[model samples]
Target: EDDVIWTVLDRVEISDDYTVIFHWKAPFPYGKAMIAISSLINYPYHIYGKWAEKVDPTVPVEEEPNKSLVASLKEFKPPRPITTGPFIFKTATTSELLLVKNPNYWAADTIENWETWFDGVLCRPHMADYNARLNNIMAGEVDLSFITVPKETVDSILTVPGMRFVAPPTASFFDLDFNYDKYPCNILEFRKALAYAIDRRAVQEVAAYYGFPIDKYATGLPKTFEEEWLSPEFLATLETYEYNPQKAEKILRGIGWSRGPDGNWRDAAGKQIKLAITTWGPYQDWVLAADNISHQLTKFGFPTELRPMPPELFYDAWDRGDFHLRVWYVGFWSTLSPWSGYQSTFGWDLTRPESLSWKGRRGLNPKDAVWAAFLVDRLGRAWKPEEQKLIVEKLAELHNKNVPLIPFVQKREYMFQLDGKRVTGWPDPDDPVWDGVTAQGPQCYTTLLVKGILKPVR
Candidate 1:
């Protein structure tokens, strides 16, 4: 029922014994490119196929079907695994999951695709406390972590023997999601004013660990996608939200906000309007960015508070829509297209409750014109790139005008520093790897290990 990515279909047609084709209910312009990505089709379904029919619907439907098809995958013990990929899922535990190269792999050593370095791979989940994870790295307990390390420690770590670093604007996007269902913020003029008051460039410099951002601070889409997807007319006509305290104050004044004796703002009722920016912690960059936002807003004569909470409390509060202002990632990953991000963030679909549900955290509703534009874009039946470009341009125009989400950084230039002595030859920027920054180093390592390009230093 949770069909968050709606393009995935329930029905597939087998054209031949070995050939199959997918059928989507709609044109879904991005469907073909994302089908393999957004859905799982490559898994060897025959081995686990037996569980599909075995699932007894008779067992009280209210409770979870006592036995699930997935349960079979879990029952698989160590070493023995039913897989089609180059490696076999070997072992899994609380702290680690291991994968080993398959000797019976279809592409044997004699084949060019069969070349591999490591016989097996071990993966360790980084602890919630980032420092603990870093300590493990320093102590040689963990070989690599693709997550952005403590920014201050990066320089010193780079100087360490056999250590290397790669820092770029990976798919992670940082922005302040406004709760349009809430008060002042719900007002378009007020939101636009807030956008004008804060400077994203300053925030990016302080929050992003990279020496320089890969793209200019964004309004909706990433800088990398701007040339191809964004409409030139939209850029020329849209409000760019450059930092101007005077203009921000002017906009608030037009909205009936008055300056009180305390230099803070008060509504027509004389009640002071305060804004607090809350962000998740355990990552210094998140806190620092929130603090920077707070500082900038304060300069606009708006009182702001920075509440940095632990991830648990932060998410609980976020889900409840309790914060006046929240800064967090808005779901853009390298493997995904921008359209996926826009829909899941603002589309009017009951299946995706987190996007615009009044009771949910994002606080947007179907009233936004952006949702309508997105639907129109999806409706075009033509599959040509020219037709796709026109649709994307329309979507971009509506998105840039509304300012539902303001982004500071969005790119695929993410990198992780690694200890060369432990494992070497990580993927370079030119590598054909499509996966971005992931745990157990970049997903590129997974491919390199199979291709025998990456190796254990010893």
Candidate 2:
């Protein structure tokens, strides 16, 4: 059981062949929203039931099932993919994948005029090369794409005759995360000093041209929900860690730190402070942001280096808490609730041994741990919006006080481009469908395709 679901779910019951019901352990207000966007899939019983039958329900599968049912599941590779959607896998290669429309789709006759306009979808891999993808888009070789275009190139891309750019708000944001177990960063005063020294606006203007600088008093919650869930009076109480190099110098000096003749910060013990910011190399924006931050901190006396690693190595470093500081992406995925954001930030309940081992490795304060547990519990039990708001406010307060993670920018829009000559029914900028087509919303293209809103030009 995943930690997120385990907290709120007691058990699931299959009431009938076509019906399934969930029993919540508490009054989880986000139950419906959670299920709607959950990636949990219903595996075909005929193929998977054989493994399930071997398990002894009385004993834990981890012990009795020596090889472990999970390991077996992981090793079991189906000859082909099985799906119950509008399309079925036709073929795949290193370069491309093809999926043809399902003729016997269950909803074919259920809905009026239900039909897929295109015979199939052909997907090609760009291998994280944005320039190649953009080239394809400009040449009209690609019908649709969700590439991240730099702000300066938007006007040039618009010059393409049949190209259309659709940008919508997303819940995603970039943050600077500190490894709490490491030195210098582990110190609260040092963290605050670094936060004050680094200019978030500079990062936004330089690397995040399409993104907005996070609020000076960010509370772990995305900017979109700040105004909705927090009151003006409560928001005013938070500390705004604005860009102030002088304040940073003062804090470091008060903590018994001094600058060496070489212009590097020396700790009380006379050790020069050297740090590195690790970020994924494939993401151009993240690389630029990390480089910009490293330069700022290096200039501010703490010699910092930008370490750009591949995605796999970067994630491994993050999971193992190996680096001093790193660029992290924080978001609730497809949910707009503050509960998901808080859970992602605080690691839900620290009481859970697994969560403690995985994320609680951050060495959270005991008092903060208690508050986080209370917030998670209270939010789960609060059924009314007003009641949930009160609990969320407290969580935000705690986040504001302790600079657990320094949020840099909030992605306000996602750049999605399409060839208007190939498809005629793309949603306009002001269409209501756009509301459901965000990082925190349903799959927009899938919804449009199923609803017969998009059709190929005849």
Candidate 3:
């Protein structure tokens, strides 16, 4: 005998205390039958205790800082049912995080959650030191980690039981970034001299700590299972700048730089044949390479001052084109196709207004510019039959002359360890699709989730 009531009513305000009165067409208790009337009290004002004083709502959200390694993930707006990975984020405090298994997860049956394996997971990202994380992994306190451990540590870790290594292909290139905008290096011959004066192979073997291989020409123009879209000629232009120490000295002498009484070379303007060598932080391998390069350059009467500083300062000086000689790793990649990364590194992007200073600094030469224009013109539009023909031809020419970029080494990817209980899922060691030279991609964490490697702890 339950019936829902529906009604339309109107009320009017009377006083401060009485507030208002309501009137309805139908009355429940006044049907001539003896009944009790129930009335609900109404209040006029809302009770509040000074409503927590507004303390200037945390500064209006701003865009991410420019030219930084760290980036905001907010812009990506990935599709949902979000990531189909194993783990889902539970809670994230400042110091630590908690990861829980998805109750609705599809793989619960095959993986066996609490029945045989762990129940949940916890992770604390950005752990200050890499070695500390590795030590924890070795002591069985941690299950996994994603820190870049040194090769020495990796060698030691390989001998441990219940542990394995996953070596993934990485997009890293270590080379002398010639500041074509600055003096000495402004002269192509001088740039060529510097290139030939140093032994790239030795530098790669020693400086990288065997972390990467000598790529000789670091361009994303080559085709592999993971990526494609480069023409052969675009790769060939770079080969012309191979190592030649004798030719380096000859080029220096031809530039009116002659050996002086002090066993150093002096230019016709009496400017000492010296280079300002800059490095970021204390990269021992690069420091060693710089030292050796300086030693060899001195043989041709040129002395180099090695200036090592933090990356922030180094990048500041580099962007301003204030460096003499510097070393940095370029993660080249393309957005349209992996091959576009090669052109970006060597072509129009190098000379683009955003990449160069407008205050009188010139970047890539016209020869490089021509190749870049072709790339841009091709990619600027959707694939057309005519454009495709032109792209292939232009790329072949660039590759043949090695016109785009002078690549030297390929970087190796390393991960720091974490506790097994804490680390539940990780990406498989494989070539990254958006590797610097392959694609313009997101960060590691995002990539891991996208690739479906980061599973949850059941």
Judge candidate 3 at residue 352 and give its lDDT. Answer: 56
Which whole-number lDDT from 0 to 100 does residue 422 have in model 1? 66
Ranking by TM-score: 2, 1, 3
71-147: candidate 2 lDDT, tens digit per residue: 88889998878877677889998868898988887876654455536677787774547677677767777777665
Which ranges of candidate 2 are over 4 A from the true structure? 65-67, 110-116, 352-363, 439-442
Which 10 residues in a row give candidate 3 its minimum summed lDDT? Answer: 29-38
C-alpha lDDT values of all predictions: 0.62, 0.76, 0.49
lDDT tens digits by residue: candidate 1, 21-68: 777666555566455444444445565556555655556424456445
In terms of TM-score, which candidate is strongest? 2
The candidate with the higher lDDT, 1 or 3, is 1
Instruction: Name model 3 segments beyond 4 Å from true.
Output: 1-127, 130-142, 145-151, 209-212, 215-239, 279-302, 332-336, 346-362, 367-371, 379-406, 416-458
TM per candidate comes to 0.79, 0.92, 0.59
Output the number of the lDDT-best candidate. Answer: 2
Instruction: Between candidates 2 and 3, name the one with more favorable TM-score.
Output: 2
Query: In model 1, what are the clashing residue pairs, if there are any?
Result: 168-413
Q: Which residue pairs clash within candidate 2?
A: none
Stretches off by above 4 angstroms in model 1 are 1-3, 7-10, 13-17, 41-51, 54-116, 136-143, 149-152, 209-219, 231-234, 309-312, 332-336, 350-382, 411-413, 417-420, 427-443
Number of clashing pairs per prediction, in order: 1, 0, 39
